[model samples]
Target: MQTSVTFKNIDPSDHLKSYVQDKLNRFDRFLDNPAEASVVLSVEKFRHIAEVNITGDRLKINGREETNDMYSAIDMVMDKLEKQIKKNKEKIRERRGSRGAVKASPMVGFADTLAEEDAEGEIVVTTIDYKPMDAEEAVMQLDLIDDSFLVFTNAKTDEVNVVYRRNDGHYGLIQPIR
Candidate 1:
């Protein structure tokens, strides 16, 4: 992976640049070929902040750390990035399942089959429950579970919604419309 290190409110140093590059290289295993990583180092009062941004195939991962020591901050940021990558991988796996097969079936036939199966199996054949909640509650649940996103039923619309944590330390919500 190619890396670019930028120093803000601080002079560029060879040691710091090399350290950032080395730490980011660890992500090479997670991506096919990372396009380029942008690392920003800045000093805020007594704290040194390190931010790493990586872009890959439809995936963008970012990590930031603030500490008194620049090297420690870099290390912490890299660790966070690794964790994010792992979480994303797990989510993708869960959605796709082990058998990565997509067979197109007519919606009408599929819905008919689903209704028949439900009637046959009074027992909950599949068990996934969604609670009615708002975006803030979904975010809290995500944080408590250490998951990237939480799926819940919207309290107002009674629709399924998803809330995820973004790289910029903000939340993103997705709602589907019929």
Candidate 2:
């Protein structure tokens, strides 16, 4: 992995640079191709902040952490980035591994009940052209769009699926089960 370390509000030190390089080397096992990592270390009053950005193999990951100790901050941020990479890798595997599996579709419909009500309160229905895509692709689409949820046909199972942003800043996938 190629790494660049930048210091802010602190003097540049070779020790810190070597420390970061050694730490980032551990991530090589998770990546198939060479990756570029940009790291920023800063100290503000009592807070020591660390930020990392990694890009490679059609993936970009970022993590930030702040702690009382600079070393601990780097360690924590790296941990966060590692978890994201692992999750993305699993998503890719799941998408490919299920390609040949057959699935049954479930019954789903939206009920439109028109009753006498105030003009101010009304339901607005919008039709969208949902394209067939894998779950990982659906996630990429969700990130590009401002919508909280996306509906698409699963490329592997030929069933409609919903990907939604959860309250915890994670994604949720909804699929029908028979």
Candidate 3:
């Protein structure tokens, strides 16, 4: 896991950064390869705010917490992130158990619905918000929806790509030949 911490309205402290890193390290047991965490710690007049975004294992989870103490805020946010990770993992496990019934996580593109198919299997076009993100982000986006595939712009390549859930509980990517 890679972690980056930003401090706002507060002095940068090794102690604080280490604190956040230690807390996030515990999540390694729950995430797979290429996990990245972006943490922002800020202080207001009376509120210490922590914002965390974790991307890994085809999942993107964000948690924010505010408290009177910085440590408290970090703890609260970490707890929230943990719950989200567990809930998402549980949902995926359940879906995997009945793989045939739901082979793919939905083609989730910012919550847009998939195109409808006619009874005769005619194709229909559906418009979605295309965002530039990596393949892992695309897969994570797909995991949250009910569609089988997602079309997105690859942030690295700056080209359109398709990511779909496979029947074997994995993911497939389709890219254009340039």
Candidate 4:
């Protein structure tokens, strides 16, 4: 897998870089294409923070941890990522029994919801064409742009899906059931 390490508010060292790369390489066995992994190491006051993002095929997993030592933070983050991948694998296995079976449509209803508080001056609106693509490509486009979230139609199911960057420096996918 292609790995890139970035250090913020800390001096870049070959030793630290190699350490992170070595730790992230353990996830290679879980991925098919492996794609690329981005690791960010930063220091906040007394805490050492490590964040890892790996995107491959239809999977995008991210994990972050803060500890007194950078190496320990990296280890914790990798452990969290492993747990997420295992959980996702289990979910897929559970659904294998329903393979090729058409599922019933879910009921939909709308309830009155409060509007979001806008603190940034007046309302601003922008429009863009909705394109159909897979979740992986949608995330790649989000990273390439300045937006925090992207909405696109899923190429496989033709359903609307959203890919957004989370506060913990990870990506979140939202798929609406119809």
Candidate 5:
């Protein structure tokens, strides 16, 4: 990753520049292609702000943090950037994996191998922010995504819920029993 740091309303410090470079270097592994990062550090009265913008491959990520100190703001913004990088990488990997995978046909002898693999299935755990939303709004959100199902926290009941598109062209909702 190539990084450039800009200081606003404060004297440029070599220490701060080096710190940002070191932090940006860690994200290079998450990116398959080379990336460019632009960082801005500014101070307004008592508020210190750090902002970073990164562009690589076909994606862009931005993170901003405000704190009483510049270093803390930089650290917080870096944490946010790391999360964004990991999420982007995971999405790319998922797209590639889903497209390349081929299922064995039942007519072929390989069906037995596939059955054994299914018996010892690989479990994947994905963490999503279950933001509270009403059922109608969640249904609308599901329409915007390519996925058939969505998991969300219900605003009215304050419980985890799922909304899925049924095979019959209707939608179904799932809620846990009280």
Candidate 6:
């Protein structure tokens, strides 16, 4: 792991730098690839803030904590980052299990195996139980959830429709044309 520490509104101290490096080294076992961490330690009046941003293979994590003591702030932020790393690793493991692992077949060439892997990424199928509701009701229901898109049966036409949030901050409705 590579780490860079920055101090803002506080004098740089070797003790603080070494302390953070040691704490970050403890997370090496949780990572598969070399990771770079950027840590910022700042002071605002009586508040001491510590923030760490870690970037590695397929992962980007950030943690920030503020307290009266700089040491405590560093410890708290490291704990938060560790928890997030563990949680993200578990989620990756779960996703891998859901998607069958790729194994090179005995008779298949290396190129063939690569093509198989690419095909696997083409489409993902998931089952969703859509509820029946009107278009207006669907829009209202979508607002109450965090999903980017929702599927609901249009009450008036009894047809399936999708209500989604657009990048332009507008709602889009997808209905099949008869």
Per-residue lDDT of model 1, residues 115-142, tens digit only: 3344554753333446777677666656
Error of 1 at 171 (Å): 40
Write candidate 3's Cα lDDT for 1-178 as tens digits.
7999999999999999999999999999877567999999999999999999999899999999999999999999999999999899888866764664333333335444376555566666557667688898778667656468888899999999999999897999999998
Which 10-residue span in candidate 5 carries the lowest summed lDDT? 103-112
**lDDT-better candidate, 5 vs 6:** 6
- List residue ranges in candidate 5 displaced over 4 A: 103-178
Candidate 2, residues 1-178, lDDT tens digits: the string is 9999999998999998999999899999989899999999999999999999999977999999999999999999989998999998778765654563432122112223455464666755545557788998777666544358788899999998999999997999999995
When 3 and 4 are scored with lDDT, the better candidate is 3
For candidate 6, lDDT tens digit of each residue in 33-149? Answer: 999999999999999999999999689999999999999999999999999999998788656545653321222111122223335447544456676777777665565443587
lDDT of 2 at 143: 56
Clashing pairs in 1: none
- TM-score per candidate, chains pooled: 0.54, 0.56, 0.56, 0.53, 0.57, 0.56
When 4 and 6 are scored with lDDT, the better candidate is 6
lDDT of 4 by residue, 1-178 (tens): 7899999999999999988788777877766565688999999999999999888857788898999999899889988988987787556644652462432112111112344455678554444455788888777666544367777789999998888899997999999978
Model 4 regions lying over 4 Å from their true place: 100-178
| Candidate 1 C-alpha error for residue 80, in Å | 0.6
What's model 6's TM-score?
0.56
Off by over 4 Å in 3: 100-178
Which candidate leads the pack in lDDT? 3
TM-score for candidate 3: 0.56
The whole-model lDDT of each prediction reads: 0.76, 0.83, 0.85, 0.76, 0.81, 0.83
